[model samples]
Structures are given as structure tokens and as C-alpha cells.
Target: MVATVDVRHETLRRLKSGTGKLATAALRELDADYRWFGELPAQERSWVGTVAQAGITSFVSWYANPTGTYRGALEIFAAAPPELTRSVSLQHTLSIVRTVVKVVEDNADELAAVGGEAHLREAILRYSREVAFSAAEVYARAAETRGAWDARLEALVIDALVRGEVDDDLPSRAAALGWKPGPTLVVVGRTHGPLGETQSAELRRSMRRAATGAMVGIHGEDLIVIARSDQDLRELASSIMESFGPGPVVIGPPAVTLLEVARSARAAFAGVVAAPAWSLSPRPVLADDLLPERVLVGDTGARDRLISIAYDPIVRAGGSLQETVATFLDCGRSLELSARTMFVHANTVRYRLKKVSELTGWDVLSTRDAHVLETAFALGRLRDAGRASL
Candidate 1:
């Protein structure tokens, strides 16, 4: 009997000589020597039959020994396979399939750069079943590498925080790192038109750049920033307006410390809440000193009966009754400074003073009455501040 090796060598020589298309040559060679096809494994035989039926010439040679010396020659003549026409050549269809499987297997580094171990496992499950032999092994290696990279990145972030590598202003630096503290300024806004996520992120970055020493955070749909100085606060406000267009930003005043931010935030929130009309206009409203008159007006009830008796009616009238008293006291009862502060002609200032005297039956020019009015005014403001809280 002829040796199997001699039979294999003769078959290979015949295949090389037959220059018809890969599938056609394969079939012709197999027909001349049917024993070779008979010797193939069941799966290989089935694959060859499927390739013939699909009119794919490249896949015919895949049933041959995958790592044989003739493998390169078979691949060179391969045509596009059926479903894999977009992916690889038909003559060397098995090699093409193997390459695709390898890519998904090797993607561990890419995935790890974006995330880490968590993502590595996810990627394996995502692409494994879709790829060819040994794909699971490839993905496993990738996941391990990716997980390691992610851990490194997280360590870096924590190290930066512990090392105090952030900026000098405590509040601003903390805000950037998503820390919560007292004395934060909450800024709430809704865009007038649609914006992409990229645009929103860029806008936030621009605001931070402009503010320099401000800490900015995102709460739901709003931007909250904490500034260490009035200058940073002002710049942040201005930059936001410029970027978003002229709309109002309601800012709570700086809390005395981190612990006081909540109270300051409440006051600022209340100021905006009271003025719903300005919500559509997009102006910046400062919570601390801007609404002092209103806060003082509301606090008038805190005064003892003597002070209330002097200023209750004037306060109820909607004008700033507390401010008039403060101005009077600040001017040392001088009508000139009082007039300038009240932004009125001296005569108009005199008229209001006259009215105050009449309300309490206290003479405006009396030394005793001046002292009484001063005390009453201070008490009324304190009362208003207290009432505003309610």
C-alpha cells in the first residue's frame, strides 16, 4: 500500500498545479482524490460542504490542515466568503476569521484605559460569544491589564487630594473635587434653548477659567460655585451671564464659614423665591447685603413695644422704613448727609423726617426724640431680619 505521507504529498502537488478558482480547484482536486476529503473531521467536512453551497471559493481550503505548510498558498488564492465578504478573504477564510477573533481578544488595553477591572469583565461577556476560538483567553488578558490601569488612576486622584495639590483657596479647591462644605453659593439656571452635553461641559469649564479661585459644582441641573473672595464671585457671575446670555443668576451670599453656608443659601434662595418675576430675565441677585432692607423690614417685630410703637405703620407701607432710620442715625441727624444717602433733595428728606416725628409725636429736632428714634430703628431692623426667616 502507498504510504499516507506520499499520498498527502501527491495531493498537495495536484492542488498547486490546478489553477482554477480556490473552491473549484479544491473540488476538482478532491474529486480526483476523494480519500483526502474522507479523512477530514466531521466539522471540517460540514464546513466545506456549506462553503460550496454558498458559492464561496475561499472557504473550501479552510477544511485543510490549518497550520500546514500549504496554508499560505491556499490563503493567497482565497476569494471572499459568504457572510464574511465584508470581513475577510474567501481563499484563506479561516485565517481571516482567526484575525477578527484576535482583535476583540486584544482590546483589554483600550478598555482598561477608559475604566478597569469592572470594564474588563464586562467587555469579555460583551464580545466573547461573537468571536472565534480562544477569544475568551484574549479578553481575559485585556481585562486584567485594564483593571490595573484603572486602579492606578483612582490612586492618583486620591493622592492629589491628600497631597494638597489643589489651589490655595480652600472652598474653591474643595468644590472642584466634589466636596460639600458650609458657605456655598447655589446658582440655578435653565437654558433658554437646547444645548449639547459637550457645550454644557465647555461652558462650565469657561466659567471656572474666568473665576480662577472659585469652586464650582453641579447639582441636578444647576451650577453651584463657592468663591473665596468678592472679586472671584463677581467674575464668576459675569462669566456665566456672558456664556449663557443675559439671564439672571440667583446667588446666596458668602456664609461666614462652611457651616454657615446653609443659612446663607436659604437667605439667597428666599430672595429669589420672593421675586418670581425676575426668573425669566436672568439677572444676578446677591443674597447677603443686597436685600438688607427687606430682611431688616421683616425683622421689625423683634423690637420691644417702645420701638414697634414708633415705626410699625411706616414699615407696613412697603417703603423701606428701616433704611430711613439707619440713614438718620448714620448722618448724626444732619439733614445734608441723610438727604444724599436717601438720594432725595434736602427738602424731601426733611418731609420724611417731619412725617416720622408726626407718627410718634416726637419732635424731629429734640435731643431726646433723636435718641428714641435711633433705638427704635435698630430694634425694628432686627425684628425684620427675624421675621424674614419665618
Candidate 2:
């Protein structure tokens, strides 16, 4: 009993220190040192002693007067004795302390309402500081875990490839590791906080869910995922959009080998740059043979000029100048087939051909002009594809 009393007193002290005025006032009013069990009539004293001895009176007071301003105290005289046993006997004493603590927590607003501003502010500042310290500790632990997981994941990927555990599409294997070669897709996702240790675990889970069978790596602030199978690439990308909110996703056209993944990644990166104004709606953009073309167009600006020429109102009103050029090129420079493919009387094709020559100041009939236009068209298509991906 003495041990239980000491523990109860200590616990109440902690609760009082942790809380505000209501809990402290309730504890003071309990007058725990007084023993009135033997003084009153048998029935009345029986109820009063039970409440006082059980520590229930203090609990009731704390719970009822949470802000320490209630005019009436709680009356638990008629309540029956709480069940007690050897194991939980100490708990009965602690229950009073817990009750006080709970009242303080639940009535923080009430305390503030009752003009406990200084006390409330001090409590809030202390709680905030504790939470901040705990969060920093958690972040540090996560960072350490992430570093170990990264190394393990990298080794796992390299070992799987070397042991022939993966299928013979070596390019796909290379692409997953951010290597530059083969058909590839690059996906970027935002994390909850600055990159730390748990990110690798979260990433691995995401990759497994995407089922891309690709090697995933983190480069600075970006998540770089590579995969060889176009189907897997598409599925992985779709899953990422669903799991994380849409941002930017880019898929590069199939390359011949793993050495081309870097080129594909660069193309995808460029795509992300082109459409800064456009937002993704959970969709991924695909660029096939257009990647190289886009690079050329972006580097040289000639592709834009070609588009202006092809779609210009003056060119279209006269006749489709670009279509005529396409037919001419497809016919291997054979004027007869070019005229037939145009679906116009050879005389009409000839006249439109004349008009194209006059407007562009280049003879569509010339091999040099044909070559230049074809190259420009290819470049324009690639650039367009890349932009779509971004």
C-alpha cells in the first residue's frame, strides 16, 4: 500500500507539471492526507470513504472542472467501489493521475477561455519543441536506412542481369539503371520530404507495383527509372501517375542497344523542358523516331520555318504544297508517279508544282530541294513528338 501511494503521488506530480491549472486545482482539493473513513454514519461514511480511498474523487473533480473555474465539485459518493486485483491494484491509483492528465488535454481550449493564456502558451511551446526534435530524429534514421537500401537494390539489379536471371533483352536491363541506350522511359515523382533513407524503400514498393522490372535510381532530387520493354514502360508510367499525382512523364523511342538509354533519357528530359506551360493529366507522352528529329529542330530552328511553309494560308489555298512535295519524294523523283499519286490530272499536278516552286523559290522538281524538305519534315515531327511527351 505504501509503495502504491508513492507511485501514485509521483505520477500525479508528473501529470500536474505536464498540464494546466484545472488538474492542479483538482489535486489540491482532494486533501488526500485526511482520513475520514471512521468518522461518519455507517451508510454515509461507507460511500464517502470508498470514493476517497479509491482516488475517484480527484478524477471526477479534474474531469468536471477542466478549466479550474467550475463552482460545484463532482459528487461520486453513491458510485460503487471499482473492481480491484493484485495486477491492476496499482492502476487504480494511477487512474486518478490519468484522469487529471486527460482533463487538461481535452480542456485546453477551456483553459484558454478562462484566461490561462500564459500557461497555455508555455505548454504549447514546450510541446512544439518536443515534436520538432522528434521529427529530426526520425528523418535522420530514414536517411541512414535509405543509403543501405540503395546499395542493396543496385547490387541486386547488377547481379540479376549478370546471372542471366533476366530475359535476353539486355537493352532493357541497361535502361533500368539509367544507362543511355535502347528504347527507354524516364519517370519523375515528388517525395514527401527531402530525399532520405526511406525513399528507396518507398521507391522499391512503387516499382514493384508498376511491375516494370527496371533498375531504379535516385539522382539528386529526381527519381530516374529505366525499362526496355515498351509495354512495361507504359504500365510503369501509368502506375506512377496513379500512385503519385501527375507531373511529367516521357518515353523515348526504341533504340538498337543499351548504349542508347542515355540518349533516350536526354530526349525525355528535353521533352520535359519544352512544355513547361502544359500540365499532365495522368498521361505519359511517347516519342519514337521523333526524338532525334526534335533534337535537330530545337538545335537548328529550320524545322519551324518548314512548318510555317507547309501550313501557311497562302500555300494551302493554292493547293497542298507539302502534300505535293511528299508525293514527289515518295515517287523517287519520278514525275509521272508523283502526278498519279497526287490524284490530279498530270497537268494540274504540274501547275501546282510550278506554284510551289514560285512560292518557296526552290524547284520542288530539283533533287536538292526534295532532300532539304524531307529532312526538315523529319526534324519537325521529332520535335513535336518530344514536346508531346513532356
Candidate 3:
């Protein structure tokens, strides 16, 4: 027993004296073996060197008392900045551990007592295994922290959009979250009740699978998703429609890039407000499709757009279309009555209606399009009358 104790003491003494050399040797191995090691920024590389030195020093202390607690493995990583966990991946860390162990093993015979090389090699293996596990814990904790921070940042960006308070920082903040210049759109809908972490993560994963990039935010009962994709925005919205709660899912118009995403988000938010007005609207409805409802709810932008789309074009066609449409709508949409009121052939009235649909893209024959056209024409006439009075 005394002989074994003396050998152990002798081995520990040598390991303590050579910790610096072992660390340097391990770093050399890293530089020689790993291409990524040299590519790390200078500060990060310095941090990695600190970590390697910490590991060797800790291992020597653990060797001094083999039966002591194994906290040294964890303390080794504490020597470096936390950001090192991100710069050096878990795989690269394990490689570092292996290289350090190999360095110690190569010198074991020289460092150990006359008969202690085998015991020194075993200690290296055991200590390396503990360090490997510690590295994993460090990386896992870093990932959790990073994920939490990203979630908060995403919520902030989404809130800014919902409130129409976007600034120049929005694009930069979004870029930090991996959003780039690309076709993007916003979707507003009800969330699936309340989401726990697991469900929220799954929903996010599902959305990402459907688009090139996706960010989600939950405000009260609302689920807002901003997605970028090479695919059509409408198709991307449809693919993720089932992820929302049982309510209308309104898709904003696509933005050319993240810098313009606020416009899309604002339109989507407006659509969500106006969607309830259209009770029979599709689950994934376009914000533009709700123009009439949006106009009814005091959206001046929608009112102007509706007039431009449905009324101005018919007047611009200049074939007596405005009078014919107003007369036909006033005559209960009856061709004969319209023709009689206008003193024209019924076919003439029919031909004018066709031209109205062709020019305005709103068919007077359909109930929905007819209401849109009627509302737009009335709004347009009201605006003109106000201007004339002015």
C-alpha cells in the first residue's frame, strides 16, 4: 500500500510540474489536427487555449487525490468566457479533450514513477471521460440560453410590427435572428389555446419546414408568424394554416424584403381585425380580399384601394359604363329594366356590363363583386361630391 501511494504521489508531482507543457502540446495537436481551430478568431483561440490549460491543471489536481470529487472537470471550462461554448462546437471540444489526453499519455512513461505508467494512463482515460461530459453540459446550457434570448428578441420584433413602431433597427434585429432580404409575409391568427414549451417548439418546427425562414410570436390569444420563402407566400401560408387555432388566418401581402416586412405585418394585423366582419371568409384569407370589410371598419387605405380597384377603372373606360352600372344596380340587376331606364337595347346593357367586368375585374353578376363595386362607386361619388363642394 505504501509503495502504491508513493508511486501515485510521484506521478501527481510530475503531472503538476508539466501541466504547462501538456497544455501547449495539446494546443499544438489542435492546431495541427483541426482546420477549424486555426480559423477561429484570435480572441476565441485565446479562450480555447485558456480552456485547454485549465483542463490540464485540473486533471493534475484530480490525479493528486484520485478519490476526490470530480468537480474539476466542470471548473476547467469556467476558465474561459461563456461565448467560447458557441465558437467551439461540442465535436471540436471533444477533439480537444482527446488531444489533451493523447498528450498526457505520450508523456506518461516519462512523468510517472518507475512502475506507475499504467496507472497514469488509466487516470488520463477516466479524467478525459469526465471532461467530455462536462463539455456537453456547458454546450447544452449555452444552447438553452441562446434559444431563450432568441425567443425574446423575436417577440420584440413582432410586437414592433403589430404596433406599427418599426424603426431602422428592425432590419438589423431581424438579420440577427437569421432573417435576410427575401420575400416575406406576415400571418395573424388565433393560437392553439395556450402553448407549453414543447408545443410551441413543435409549432415553430412545423412552420420552418414550410418556409425558408419563420419567426413566431404569441400576443394574448393571437399567433403571429412572419415567414420568408422562395415559394409563393399564399402557398406557404396555406401550408402552415393548420398550426393556428380555430379562427381566420389572415395573410398579409408579400414584402420584397425584411426591411419592408412592416407593411406586410400591418396589413395582416388590419386583416385580422377586419376578418370577423366576413363571417364566411376562408381560413387562410388574403388581406387584400378583405378590402370591403377593412373599408367598412374605418381603414382609409382600404377605402382608397377599393375605389381605385373597383370604381375608377370603370369610369376611366369611358363607354357610359358608370351610368349603365348605376342604372342596372338601381333596376334590381334586371337587363330589361336597365335597358328601358337607359333607353337602350338589352344587349347593349349586357355588353356594357361585360365591359365593366373586363375593365374593373369586378363582375357585376356576382353577389360579392357586386357589393364591392357598389360600395366603391358610392365611396368614389361621395369623394367627388366633397371635392366639387370644396
Candidate 4:
């Protein structure tokens, strides 16, 4: 150890006088060969030149005081005016540093002749690796900072879109996140708590492979996913349904475009809130299919939907289809009782029911479908009475 120190000190003093020459040689080599560096603005080029000079002087100090200089040696470059890191990428900076290191390395034998015991070439190699790692650290920190800002931007977009707020800047922010504006469906559920690192990575990887643009965020306990319209909501919900802590995975109706998806996002959120009312709801439940529960939870939009989709269609078919459904439901879905009420053959009731299904897509024969129609009738009656009052 003592001999190594002695050699380091001796070599350090001998190389001290040539630090100016070393920087000039490095710059001459860079200017002669590296076309990229030559094209940089004059100010940035001056910064790079300062770093080159610092690199040579730091090397001489580091050769002698290995422990002390390793950490602080890079500060000279770090504290340079205008900051060398601003315009010059770490990659380009490393190239400049490499040229300086190479200049010294090419003169390694001559530099070593100053002291027999000093391993000048070995010291340079070790310092070169540390410099590379330090360069990488700066870029890594920048990436992490950018990532945090992006996450905030994404959350802001979700809040605005979900709340139906629109402004001139919304589209630009979406573009920043690489969101492709298209028809979309919003899904709401609870996210499985704090996924393992591997599981979290795989979830993103799987989503990318699916070739569907998606934005995922957590609003309190609800996990929301906005996926492309062509992506099957049921499949997406089912695949990650288990990840939800509890309750149904509710999918909203498809919106024609992302800017128009507030309705879907709102419906998805409302359906998930109301999902507990229906114990038998499908694992991946549809918001449109949850009209009864949504109404029970005071979702006026769901009430409006049922009135429009279920009641209006039947009523528009000119009363026959409407009467058949009302009779069938009142009779507990009994064809005979419905026929008796209408004073017609059961086949006539059946034919009307078929027509009802063709018109409204809800079969009087389906108990669930019938129940939905019942809710629609009650809401539709109230709607007509309110309009009459107005």
C-alpha cells in the first residue's frame, strides 16, 4: 500500500505539467474525426472543451488520491457554465470523455515511466467505468423525473374527461401520452392491491401485446380502464376481474370518440357504485344491463336510458306490443293469463311477445328481461306525467 501511494504521488506530479497539452490533444482528435461534435453550437462546443480539460486534470488527481477524487472529480464538469448536460446527451459526453481517456492511454507507457510502481493504465480503466456509471445515473434520474410528471398529466386527463370538462389543451395533453383518439369503452372496478413487481410488469406487457391503446388509473378505490372500442370489454374485465378486491367489474357503453366518452365513464362509475344491489350480476357486468340497480341508486341517466330503450320502442310499436308485455309480466310471465287478459289466443300473445323481442330486444319470456321492462314501464310513466305537468 505504501509503495502504491508513493508511485501514485510520483506519477501524479509528473503528469501535472502536461494537463494543458492533454486537453488540446483530446480536442484536436475530436475535431479531426467526430463530425457530430463539430456541428454543435459554439457555446456547447466550449462547454465540451471545458469538460475535456476537467477530465484530464481530474485523472491526474484521481491517480494519486483515488478515494477522495472519485466522487467530487466529476463536479468540475457538473458545475460547468450553461451545464454540459443541457444540449449534449450523456452518450455524446461519454464519447468526448472517451477521447480524452484514449489520448492518455495511447501515451500510457510514457506516463508510467514517471514511476515504476504506478499502474497508470489500470487506474484509467477503472475511472473510465465509474465515469460511465455516473453518466448513466444522471440520465436515469432524468427519466424518473419525467415519468413522475407524465403520471400526473395522465391523472389530470382522466379527471377532466370523466367530469365532462373540455378545454383547448386537453387534446394536446392526450397527444403527449400517445393516446390515440378513437371510440372507447370505460371499465370500473377495484384494483388488486399493490401488485407484485413481476405481475405489474406483465399486466402492462400483456396490454401492449393486445395492440389496444389503454389508459389505466385509480380513483380512490376504483380502478378505471379506458380501452379502444374494438377491444372486448367483457374479455378485458374478465381477465382482470380477479384483480378487483370486490364487487362487479362494470363496463360502460362504447362512446364514438374519446372526447365523447364522458357518458361512458360516468355510467361505468355509477354502475360499479350500484353493482352490489344485484347479487347475481355477471362477473364482467354491463352498465346498460344494470339499469334497475342504477335507478335504485338514483342514477337519473339510467332511468332515462330505460325509458328510451325499453319503454319507448314498445309504445312506438302501437300499443299491442306494450300491452302484451305488461300483461305477461303481471301474470308472472304466464302465456295463458296474458291471453285471457287480452281475450286472445295464447298464440296471439306469443306472436306479440316475439314482435316485442324484435322491437326491443327484450323477450317477455326471460324473467330478467321482463323485470327490466317492468322498471322501464314505471320510469316511463313518470316521464310522461312529468312532461304532461310541464
Candidate 5:
């Protein structure tokens, strides 16, 4: 037992004395074999060297007391800044560990006492396994921290857009979370329930797969997704509709860029508020399609959109379209009744109705389009009356 203790002491002294050489050899091997390490920035490369040295020193300490607690093994990674994990992936870190272990094993003859090389080699392998585990734990903790921060930052950006409280910092904050400048759309709907962390992660993964970039915000049961892409937002929204809870999923008009995102958010949320009124609407319906419903719920933006899209064009055409539509709708969309009331032939009423559809893009014969047209005309007349009073 005394001779075995002397052999361990001799091996420990040799390991302590050769740690600097082992670290340098490991770093030289990294620079030669790993192209990524060679391309690292000067400061980051220096940090890598520090980590290699810290790892060697920590291994020596662990070898000196093999039966002692392994609690202090994590300090090996503490030699570098937290941001190091961002650039160095877990695979890359494992490669580093492998290279360092190889260097130590190659020098076992020089670093161990007489007849102790085999034991030292085995010890090196065991210590390297622990180091690999330490590296994984460090990266896992870093990812958890980064993910929590990103979630909070994303929520702030989404809240600003929903409330129209946008500031200069919004774009910067979103950029920090990897949002790029591109077309933006807002989708709002209820969720199955408040999302737990695991479910939220899965939902975010699903959304990101559908868009160039996406950020999800959960407000109670309401789940809001801000997605950016060059593809048609309505089509994109349709693809992701299944992610939302069963109910109306309202998609806002696409904004040209992030700076204009609040406009889309406002309309989308208003559509959600008005969605229950139209139970037969598609699973994912456009906010613009809900304009009449939104106006009924007191959205000024929807009222203006209804007038512009359904009312102003007919008035601008200066034909009999405006008067003819009024008569047809007032007569319950009956061409014969409208013709008798307007003292014209039924064919003339039909021609004018066709012209109205051409001008306003809403077919007077369809129940839904006719409702939009009727609401637009009423709002237009009220607006004109208000103007005349002024």
C-alpha cells in the first residue's frame, strides 16, 4: 500500500509539472486540425487557450484526489466568458475535449512513474469523460438562460405592436432576438390553454418552420404570433392555423416591414374581438374580411376600410351604380322589384348591379358581399351627412 501511494504521488507530481506543456500541445493540435478554431477572432481564440489550460489544471486536481467529490469540475468552463458557448457548439466542445485527452494519453509514458503509464492512461480516460459531461452541462445552462431572455424580449416586442406603443427600441430589441427586416403579419387566436414551457417550445418550433422568422406571445388564452416572410401571409397563416386552439384564427393584413407591424396587429386583434360574430368563417380568416363586423364593434379603421373598399369606388364612377345598388338592396336584392321602383327594365337593373360589382369588387347577389356593401353604403351616407353638418 505504501509503494502504491508513492507511485500515485510520483504520477501526480509529473502531471502537475507537465500541465502547461499538455495545454500548449492541445492548443497546437486544435489550431492545426480544427479549421474553426483557426478562424476564431483573436480574443475568442485566446479565450479558447485559457479554457484548455484551465481544463488541464482541473484534471490534475481531480487526478490528485480521484475519490474526492466531483463538484468543482464545472470551474474548468468558467475560465471563459458565457458568450463562448454561443459560438462554440457542443460538438465543437467535445472535439476540444477529445483532442486534449489524446494529447495527455500520448504523453502517459513521460507523465507517469515507472510501471504507472497504464494506470495513468486509464485515469486520463475517466477524467476526460467527466470533463465532457461538464462541458454539456455548461452549454445546457447557457441555452436555458439565453432561451428565457429571448422569450422575454420577444414578448416585449409583441406587446408594443399590439398596443401600438412602438418605439425606436422595438426594432433593436427584435433584432437582438434574430428578427430581420422583412414583411410582417400578425395572427391572433385563443390557445388550448396557457402553454407550459415544453409546449411553448414546440409551438415556436412549428411556427419557425412555417416562416422566415417568428415570435410568439401568449396573453392569457390569447396566442399571438408575429411572423415575417416574403410569402403570402394568408397562405402562411393557413399553414399554421392548426397550431392555434379551436376557434377563429384571425390574420391581419401584411405590413411591408417591421416598422409598419403595429397596423397589422391592431387590425388582427380587432378582428379577433369581432370573430365570434361570424361563426361560419374559415378557420383562419383575414382581418380585412371581417371589416364590417369590426365596424359594427366600433373599429374606426374598419369603418374607413369598408367605405374605401366598398363605397367610394361606386360614388367615384358617377354612373347609376350608387343609386341602383341602394334601390336593389332596399328592395331586398330583387332585380324585378328594384327595376319597378326605379322605373327601369329588369335588364337595366341587372346591368347596373353588374357594374356595381365591377366597381366595388363585391357582388350584390351574394349574401355576405351584399352585407358588406350595405354596411359600407350606410357608413358612407352617415359620413357624408356628418360632413354636410360641418
Candidate 6:
């Protein structure tokens, strides 16, 4: 065992003395793997050559004094320009290291005073371990840099959409990130949770698994998913509800295109902001479902929606349905009271309330729907009498 250790140490000593010879042979062997080397860009090919030389030189220095490492043994990778990593993948870089390590192992005995395969192979293994660790460090740093750059770009894209300030360059920038903006999309709820790397990635994975061609962007806690599929967005939101915090997930109205998502985003945001008004709302609630809540909170768009869908339909019908709704609701939803005031039987009042529900889809019997109807009725009357412009 002692002799084995001594011979291995002897091999390291010989290899360190033959650094010049080792570098020449390793470069020659690396060039012989010409197919992959030639395919690299000219600049990258030159980088590979420089790194190969540095690896041999570094190994000799490290073997001469194993504990005496310098700059974390990353000087070899750092010796090349930063663009070298951009041109050469970690896989390619590791391949170069393997080639150089193999050259040292195959030719170690030619430089040794006494040839022994086991001893030289041991020395090669020891040196190869350091090179492998250094290679990992380089790749890890590259990955971190790429991740930070991508995060910034992603934040920019999301901000533009959320702010509705998408520039002409947005399409190309999005394409660079493999984002294909779809026409059919919805800006669902955003920004009310602890967002970390793992959860963020899990959220994106869930979106991808939910449908093909889905793109996700986040700025701060605000996350927007552009789902291409025509499935019900509310249903989609429910499926992805785990991605959110302990608050309402307001789904914007489905948009026909990314460019049209501005309206959807506004609606979703308004719903999110107004969600506290409806304490019993579902976890993933539709933005339009909270129209009454939104309108009360000064959302002109929500008021406009209520006036258009509920009031206009009832007013346009003009079959006494509107008057009966106003009377029944004003009369505290008492059938008898409404009938007595209008000088009709209670059954006649019931028939009119049902008709109003059928026309506007807002059942006057339901307290929430009744409130929406009452607000719409007041707004509609004000508009018709020229007392209000809304």
C-alpha cells in the first residue's frame, strides 16, 4: 500500500514536470475530435483551444501543490472572455476537460521514470476531480446569470401587458423567451402571495400542463397567464387555484387576443381590488361576477357593464317588468305589498318578477341579484329622465 501511494505521488511529480509536453499532446488529441470542434463558431473554437491549454497548466500546478489552489481554481474558466461560456455549453466544456484528462492518463507513463498503470491512473483521477468541480462551478454561475437575465426580461414583458403599454419590440422580445402570444387569452388574478423560486416554477408548470401554448409572466406578486385554449377560464382558474394565496383569484373576461388583454387585465384587477366587498366569494371568482361590488368601488367599467346588460335589456323590453322589479324591490320584496301598490294580485306580481329574471338573468328573488337590479333600475331611470349621463 505504501509503495502504491509512493508511485502515485511519483506520477504526479513526473506529470507536473512535463506540463509542456502534456499540453501539446492534449491539444493535438482535442483537435482530432474535429467534428464537434469544427462545428463551433470560430471564436468558440479559439476559446476551446485556450481553455484546453489552461486545464493542463492548471492541473500541473495543482498536482505540484494540491492544497495551494488559486482563485477557487476557476482561473482557467475565467481566463477566457465571458462570451466563451455563451458560445460553449457546459456539456461542450466538460467534453473538452474529458479530452484533456484522457490525454494525461494515456501518456503519463511516457513521462514517468518507472511505468505503472495503477499509479498514474490514480494521479489522473485525483486531478480530474478538481477539474470536474471547477467545471461545475463555471456552469452553475452561468445558469445563475442566465436565470437573472431571463427574470428581468420576463418582468418587462409582464409590466408592459399589465400597464397596457406593449411596445413594437415586445413581440420580438417575447419570441426570444419562447413566448407565442395568443389571440384567445384572459388576464387572470395576480399578486397576493409569497412567491419563491420553487412555487413560481410550479405555478408555471401547472399552467403548461393545463394547456399547450400557455405563457406566464410575473412582476412582483402579480402573475398573468395567457391561456390559448378555449376552455372555461373560471374552470381553468379553479384548476390552478393552488398557485394563489388565501384570497380571491379574479379571472378577467376572456380576451380574443393578447393585444385585447388590456380590458381583461383592468377587469381582473378591479375585481381583485373589490374582492374584499364579497366575503363569501369563491376562491377563483369571475371578475364579472363581482360587478355589483366593483361598481360600488368606483369602477366605471363595472357600472357601465351593469347598466348595459341589466338595465338596457329591461328598459328595452318595456313590458312593465322594470316597473314591477322596481316596485317589488322597493316594497321590500313583498309580493303582496307590490301587488297592493300596483293594484294587482300577488300572482300577477310573481309572473312579472319571473319575466324580469328571464330577460336580465338577474333573479329579483335573490338578494344579491336584486341589489344589482335595483342599482341598474335607478341608473337606468336617471339616464332615461336625463337626470344622469351614465
Q: Which candidate is the best by lDDT?
A: 5
Task: Report, for all candidates in order, the number of backbone clashes.
Answer: 23, 15, 0, 0, 0, 3
> Tens digits of per-residue lDDT for model 3 on 112-159?
998888888888888888888878887888899998998899888888
The candidate 5 region of ten consecutive residues with least summed lDDT is 70-79
Which residue pairs does candidate 6 place in steric collision? 183-256, 183-257, 191-221
The residue-by-residue lDDT of candidate 6 on 303-348, one tens digit each, is 8888999999887898788788889989998999999999999999
Candidate 5 off by > 4 Å: 1-14, 69-73, 194-197, 230-232
TM-scores, in order shown?
A: 0.32, 0.33, 0.89, 0.71, 0.89, 0.63
Model 3 gets an lDDT of 0.84
Per-residue alpha-carbon lDDT of candidate 5 for residues 215-271, written as tens digits (9 for 90 to 100): 888887899888877887778888888899988888888776675678888898899
Q: What's model 4's lDDT at 320?
A: 83
Every model: Cα RMSD to truth = 20.9, 19.9, 2.7, 5.9, 2.6, 6.6
Sorted by lDDT (best first), the order is 5, 3, 4, 6, 2, 1
> lDDT by residue for model 1 over 1-390, one digit each (tens)?
122444444443433343233345444444454554556566565555444433222222331342443322223323322223322223234433333223323433432333343433343343323333332333344456654553354334333432334434544534544445433344544443555656655665675676543444343344445444444555556666655433445676465454455344444445544434333323776553223222344522123444556667667654654566568778888888988988888887777777777777765557656765666666677677989999
When 2 and 4 are scored with lDDT, the better candidate is 4
Candidates sorted by TM-score, best first:
5, 3, 4, 6, 2, 1
Q: Could you give candidate 4's per-residue lDDT for residues 282-316 as a string of tens digits? A: 86889999999999999999999999999998888
TM-score of 2: 0.33
